[model samples]
Target: MPTVLVIEDEPGMAAYLKTELQFEDYSVLLAYDGLEGLQVYEDNAQVDVILLDWMLPKMDGLGVLRRIRQTDDVPIIMMTARDYVSDKVAGLDYGADDYITKPFKMEELLARIRVVLRRGHERATYQVNDIQLDTKAHSAVKNGTFIQLSQREYTLLLTLIKNVNQVVSRDELLDQVWGTDYTGGTNILDVYIRHLREKIDDDDSDVIQTVRGIGYTMRTAGNDN
Candidate 1:
């Protein structure tokens, strides 16, 4: 199940968010303070998204954002009563994917979350080399043959497929696929790419190309090849 991390100092607001997110069939993690929020993220790196508050006790939301940015790039939606344009700009500059104002409608927040997640999953499949990824179905197929993928493999594949012909940087893939909550620093992306190549490209042709000093890109096979 998809998990959400809610970091809000206000008890009532936090509870409301938790309850609402749960209603959406998402596993919700609640943090009463920024410090606790960071701890929850550290303990559970698989969190799909985060709802952060601007102000909090035991470290502020921006600080938490900075710390998380140093490692994980999980999508964050900041909520604040301060409606200043400057505040929104600051949050975006600090790496927040989206921001929400206080007293907002639950439907709006849920809509934003859906858009972000959908975009993330959309990148998991591509049409290059006669392969298509149906993200909603969480499956990939080549020439009508279904490809089975582990959860992480599916996410990583989607990231590459989404950027089919573009050079997707490691950091970008990490932030979007691994999420901002991931703290691991190994060559996990490389492993997944190799796995994908083996299953999707190795026997036929190399669809995923590694641009030296840049990132990976997928190319469709030409008739000559």
Candidate 2:
């Protein structure tokens, strides 16, 4: 059975979610605050998904998300009352797999959770040439050497590698890697791409190619010809 960790502060809401998840035959773990939620996540290795609330007593959802992304890439669905696009983007950019607004239908939430879980099972790791990424382990290895990456860098590289040889647009990259709510200029993508190149491509062999106004494409050595 898939284990779900619900990190919500409200007693009523938490109870409601627990009951519904139980009805669906999902094993549910409940935590009323962000701190407790984090602790629960650390202690329990079986947690497959997390339904995180944006507002909490001890720590907010974003803080919790950041901390978790430091080590785990488990599918997270962020629940928030804030409906603004900016808020959604912030959650996505912070590494949330999905976002749900408050006052949502339980059925819809369940459906989204199913989709995220399915996707997680479908693509746990990706490999091209000598580069490898283990999404479950949240680690990247290149030529038998572990590549140390910041959270954003890891997310960025994963997105690129998923698409492989296809040209991933700047807008798409921003939306997927930085979140669509990103208000800053697109130069940030360039910066991160440069960082990835420096780390992943030691010989300056153009593993990641800039497509001028379009975006970028990740090319493996085997596909370069």
Candidate 3:
């Protein structure tokens, strides 16, 4: 059974969720406040999904979501009474995998949970040397040690690692990572490349190689193509 970490403040609602979710055969964990919830997540690495409330104490749901996304890409569903489009967009843009307004039926919530779980099962991992990137978690591991990454860094690294030795042009990376609607120079890309190098590269060698006139490529073997 998949484990779910629920971060809801109300006692009655939280208990109710625990009961219903248990009936559906899911292992459940609960935290009444955002801070406590985040701690629970950090303690339990096996948690497969999160049901985060909007108006949590100590820290709000969005704050918790942002914090978690910086290190792990765990599937998070924002549960709130606010059903506004902007609210939903903001939640998603901040790294929420799904959003459901409050007062929703248990069946619908369970269905959404199933969706995220299925997607989570589809997650993959890529490796080059000691570095590894998990598709679902959006996290990197170097020499078996966790390397926390920002969302942008994870996306950029994923793009290169997936293609391995194949050169990924700057325009392609810009469009894929920054989106087509972005109106900015490639300076940000270069800056992030530097950032990635600082974090992922060793003193003697680098996994990401610049293609000079083109873009970048990740090398698993020799420096030369």
Pick by lDDT: which candidate is best? Answer: 2
- lDDT (CA) for every model shown? 0.80, 0.88, 0.86
Q: Give the winner by lDDT: 2 or 3.
A: 2
Instruction: Report clashes for each candidate as comma-separated counts.
Output: 6, 0, 0
Give TM-scores for every candidate, taking all chains together and pairing residue i with residue i. Answer: 0.55, 0.57, 0.61
TM-score, prediction 3: 0.61
lDDT of 1 by residue, 1-225 (tens): 789999999999989998998988999999999889977886775788899999999878898898776545678889999999998998999989899999999999999998777666333234666888764455689889998877667667777776666788888878765666679984888888888888888565888888777777777666222
Evaluated with TM-score, which candidate comes out highest? 3
| Candidate 1 stretches greater than 4 Å from native | 121-225
- Model 2 residue runs over 4 Å out of place are 121-225
lDDT of 2: 0.88
Candidate 1 collision pairs? 72-180, 73-180, 74-179, 74-180, 123-158, 124-158
Residue-level lDDT of model 3, residues 1-225, one tens digit each, is 899999999999999999999999999999999889977986776788999998999889988897676556788999999888998898999999999998999999999999998877556778988899886665699998998777678778988987888999999888766655569988899999999999999999878889888999999866467
Q: What ranking emerges by lDDT with the best candidate at the front? A: 2, 3, 1
